[model samples]
Target: MTLDEILDSLEHDIAVRDDGLFAGRAIIDGRCVDVIGVSRGAFVGVDEALWLSAQVMETIRRGGDTPILVIVDSGSQRMSRRDELLGLNECLAHLAKCLMLAGQCGHQTVGLLYGHTAAGAFIATALATRVLVALPGATPEVMDLPSMSRVTKLSIDLLEDMAKSTAVFAPGLVNLEKMGAVNATLDPAQPLAAQLARWFDVQPDRADVRDRLGESHGGRPVAARIAQRVYELARHVG
Candidate 1:
């Protein structure tokens, strides 16, 4: 579905600004949520990252226990020499921290993957949410398959064949679900507003469970083991 359609289904009285970030106060089944997202498939830059951070902070400052709904459609980070020179990574990190702080401040953070959710854009925004739901056919990937093949020195055909059997290196939302990246996938034909309301009302735990879910799904057993081992080592460290 288009961004506007999604927002209309889930929110009422939407207000969009000139900055490319759209937000509206949504009331779902008596639950109030602040829904915010970037539009026009905007390549997120340092400035956009800072804007997002400010939005999350301001939501917490408002002190309403309002849930934050993040709508992600970004394909990637902006490709600008100036952005990189001025510390793009640092800006993205700040955004991630602000999202985390919002959760710590008692807001239920949720993300809806509507369009291209890829690379640093996903990490800085949607990936930090407490619960993430992806629309059917939405592709969320670390990188495109050809790019991954080039980076890993693997043949494209070989990677494609492996992706058919395993989701660890695959790119679509279905594979992402198998790897326990997204909490759930929403059907486009179904009513998303009620589903979102239920998700908000349920109030899932904020703790990170991807590693455990991945292990249970048999998609990435080593991830949980490795994390546990690292935690054990850190516990003994001075």
Candidate 2:
């Protein structure tokens, strides 16, 4: 199938009921999303993120080894008035905070990227132990190249020139690493759990890496800081 065809299915999705706990068997490195949808109510991305996060905590309270595989085939956040006012960044930050706590609780979170991941939504997905990605098929960026060029009103040619030896200007896996977005890319054909198992071995230290991400970019992304603070507060409050 063509790229557009592959990317099309993610646009409109159904939600599954997870009872607030993202607990279930995985695809063995296969796509976990297809197995788990809304699990509660509407399949809207931001709300779905919020729900799963709450579930993750419940699972942790119950026991050990809650290794959840969050397969990311998402493109971007749905544009909506409520979403804007509700603060998409806040919703995403909520999920990232949960994922970070999951790690501290001895859970291994893994994300298998199968499509474009950008902005705060991208940040939410990659907040894992070690991110396993597909081939060139998956695109990771803080802000995609086109958007950056368009919003900044800079020419694509000029941006391409900057990305020549620097990732600050481009949007890709390599560029993301330079920006400290994801940990590693996986071969599209590799099984997901196997990769996650490997990641479980060489886990990406979340807070440290996030600190680097923020340091490299001058300030951490707002969503990132919120998540960090959430964890910290949760610690003090508890």
Candidate 3:
């Protein structure tokens, strides 16, 4: 869906302006949300990352505990020598930190994935949100099959077969949800307004619990135990 379609689906009163980036306010179900994101599947780079983090900080300064809605429709980080020279990795990490900071400061940071996104762009945007909701037809690729094949030194065919058996490292909504990356999946056939409102009504506390979710879903059965052990050991040492 287009950005306009997404805003419309929320039954929101919003005014989104674009100057190579999208930022705006959306009032959904009488709840005001600050919306910021990229569009048209653009490749995120230093400038885009900085803009997003700045928007989050601006929202934080507003001092309302108002929810932040990060709408994502982007590709991976820019893969140019110039972007590398400009400290793209640090910029992306800053963006992610800003989102996490918003949540820590009492804002409900939610991510809406209505279009394609992958890699660092995905991490700095959607994955950083406290709760990530995937819209129908949203495509979130963790790693392209070819890239995964190259990285793991496994054939693309083998990866495909493995994906059928394990949600880990796969790139679909069902797989992502199973692995606890996606917190919710919006149903277009339902009243989107009510669905969103219901989510806020029963939203979980802003704590990182994906590891537990992964264990329960059997997508990552041992990760929670490993994390618990690591946390306990670190606490003991401290």
How many residue pairs clash in all the candidates, one count each?
0, 14, 0
Q: Give me the candidate number with maximum lDDT.
A: 3
Compared to the true structure, candidate 3 yields what TM-score? 0.92
lDDT of 3 by residue, 1-238 (tens): 6787777876454554453468877777888878888878888999889988999999999896888888888889998999999999999999999999988888888888888999999999999998888888899977888999999999999999998888885887778888988888998778666666655554446658998887777788888889999999999999
Tens-digit lDDT track for model 2 on 183-237?
A: 5565535443455456655443544565556446543345466777988999999
Candidate 3 residues lying further than 4 Å off, grouped into runs, are 11-20, 202-206
- Please give the ranking of all candidate structures by lDDT, highest first, separated by commas: 3, 1, 2
Q: Write down the worst ten-residue block by lDDT for model 3.
A: 11-20
Model 2 compared with the native: what TM-score? 0.65
Model 3 lDDT vs. the true structure? 0.84
The C-alpha lDDT values of all candidates are: 0.82, 0.56, 0.84
Model 1, position 111, has a per-residue lDDT of 88
Please give me the total number of clashing residue pairs in predicted model 3: 0
What are the models' TM-scores? 0.91, 0.65, 0.92
Tens-digit per-residue lDDT, 67-131, candidate 1: 98998887688869989998999999998888888887888888899888788888888888887
